[model samples]
Target: MTQHLTIVDHPLVQHKLTIMRDKTTSTAGFRRLLREISLLLAYEVTRELEMTTTTIETPMQTMEAPTLEGKKLALISILRAGNGLMDGILEMIPGARVGFVGMYRDPETLQPVQYYCKVPNELDARMTIVVDPMLATGNSSVAAIDLLKKQGARNLRFLCLLATPEGVARMLEAHPDVPIVTAALDAGLDDHGYILPGLGDAGDRMFGTK
Candidate 1:
């Protein structure tokens, strides 16, 4: 991943994102759309995966075939809401190694606090991708990246459904090498660290929680 952000604005991605953002979309409908859109985003995120040629005997003759190089990818999901995106991505990258990092914001300090973390072994040797549906304040995402770096992750990428400018800025400042891929970048964050004109509470919308 480059030291930049990529917004997957393909028609299929945008269409599904629009429906997901609508207030009338049911929990089942939203969840279904998220799963479908996740596959689309996965296409863009893994577009540049390293490929190597392998000698294979085709039905006609022997030939060289392109295949992905290196070990299975490591997907680190920022827990709770990240599961929504991770589920669909896992369906596509079925061989990927999965891990979870759980964190929550402190109401008083408005900072993220980590509670749980379990990552795969030899993270530095694999391509590590982090999934979180909404990048609101970036506090949690940055914190999660910090932990992953400590765990030996060298190649990192961040994927989200929606992002705020503040959040993106924070990530760039903290981890410029980790590129970000998102469906949309919203106007900004509200007073309480919520994205403006954004779908309210991604976890709640997907899980029917308040």
Candidate 2:
């Protein structure tokens, strides 16, 4: 099956992305925009969530209404920058279970090394969504998915604010089962593995500490 990669080009998301991309945007503004755009993207990502009917009583009469079905969704944030997106998604789906994965690159091997991992209970039963602001080289994202798979999370999706073609290709090649939901796919990656014409270091910009 072809891995689904959705590039949400919603006007609100695009407008906020542009504002966040401006070098002069303040840290506060960046954080706010990230949250706003994340919410918009989250709405798109969860559009296909399964729903069931539930009886509800209205003033006029009782009727069945649509409600989320099965297990509650899980949101796993690939730490630091991912946390920024996580916060906004949480606002939209407050009941979603939360998980964290921390990966750092090894200078010698240029590979991801997981330093931390903690996921919610019964991951296999839930639809897990991994949130990260930027998909640069896809090393950390791949590593994070590896860890999740090891933890028994079979149904998984990755959500990001920005993605590079290289990163999308890498993720597809590495893990074809996982779908990627992103706000925008920029041109490509730079020599240093940074997304071209992309907002600079997400974590640094969100935290105001380049």
Candidate 3:
């Protein structure tokens, strides 16, 4: 991708995001909105996927059918919150291979600490998309992408619901080749590195936790 970042400003995406940001929105409602937004984001993220034609015999005649080229897509969810985005996208692309990178941020330093990782094989051949709901400090997202690259993931993309300027800059500096697709780019991050105007903690909101 030529551009390093893409903001999906679709009307529906923005409307749903507004609801998700409301503090009064219930957990079930938040999760439902997330899934719906995910589909819209996935549509943009996969827009440029290579296509190939294959011969197929129809009931009346023979024709060439257009199909996706290259290996099956690999989706790497950045643990708990990423699952919300991944779950929705998976429903749209059920054939995609799924993976997870588990990590947590240290409250003291706000750095990412990885605890677990399980990914698909032949990473070099697949189009890998890493999903996360929010990109605040960018520490965890960068770390996750670094780990994936070490595992041979070459063609990669990052998808999220919201992002801050600091996070986007950090990601570009670290992994410029990987394009970023987000629903909205907020003003900036708060003192504790949380995204300002963000929908609170994505994991907590999605799972009904603290």
Candidate 4:
């Protein structure tokens, strides 16, 4: 595995991920699992955030305590599936700013085409975490990062519920600077661009659309 990719193997994350992968799991259950898993994943992803000591008066006495330093974190969700992960992460970091990037696959070229892109102010100043549920081909993921880099997002990290080996390779080759945090990395992608033995279409499963 590449150093840039961090596969979290916490028990809670694994448990919820397995439940989300089960075909018999209900839509509501799946959504709840994703949210639960996101909280654990967010904790791992944000572990390296900078902190500084600040003086504050406690109930007993005044004391200096560690607090998050610098600008507020920014989360850029690659919708619409990314929104599912984003919601739970937001719950964990309520003060963090939110952004959205929308892209749809171009059937003819099998490439991602941007339909929307919106980020908060001073993206360059804040550490940006791009959230998506799956990393299959890595085309969209790469494209999204390209756009963010163009907009001056330097310190970036990618958070996904699952990934495939092929997708990890693609991402490593294209955007090595952006570290990836995922719960599981499956065998590889299937014929139709789905992760094999992976939780079905995350968007459909999450929204109960299919």
Candidate achieving the largest lDDT: 3
Clashes of each: 0, 0, 0, 0
Q: Name the runs in model 3 displaced over 4 angstroms.
A: none
What are the per-residue Cα lDDT tens digits for candidate 2 across 1-210?
A: 134788898888889999998989999999999999999999878887889999999999999999999899999999889999999999989999999999866656557888888899899988999999999889999999989998999899999999988888899999989899998889987766678899998999999896
Distance from true location, Cα of 189 in model 4, Å = 0.8
Model 4 poorest 10 in a row by lDDT: 103-112
lDDT of 4 by residue, 79-186 (tens): 899999999999989999999999876756658999999998898999999999999899999999999999989889999999988888899999988899999989
Itemize residue pairs with steric clashes in candidate 2: none
Q: In lDDT terms, how accurate is model 2?
A: 0.90
User: Candidate 4 overall Cα lDDT vs. reference?
Assistant: 0.92
* Model 4 per-residue lDDT at 202: 96
Q: What C-alpha lDDT do the candidate models reach, one value each?
A: 0.91, 0.90, 0.95, 0.92
The TM-scores of all predictions, comma-separated, are: 0.97, 0.96, 0.97, 0.96
Q: Which sections of candidate 2 miss by over 4 Å?
A: 1-3, 107-109
Cα deviation of 166, candidate 1, in Å: 0.2
Writing each residue's lDDT as its tens digit, candidate 1 over 2-104 gives 3488999899999999999999999999999988988889988887778999999998999999999998999898989888899999999999999999998
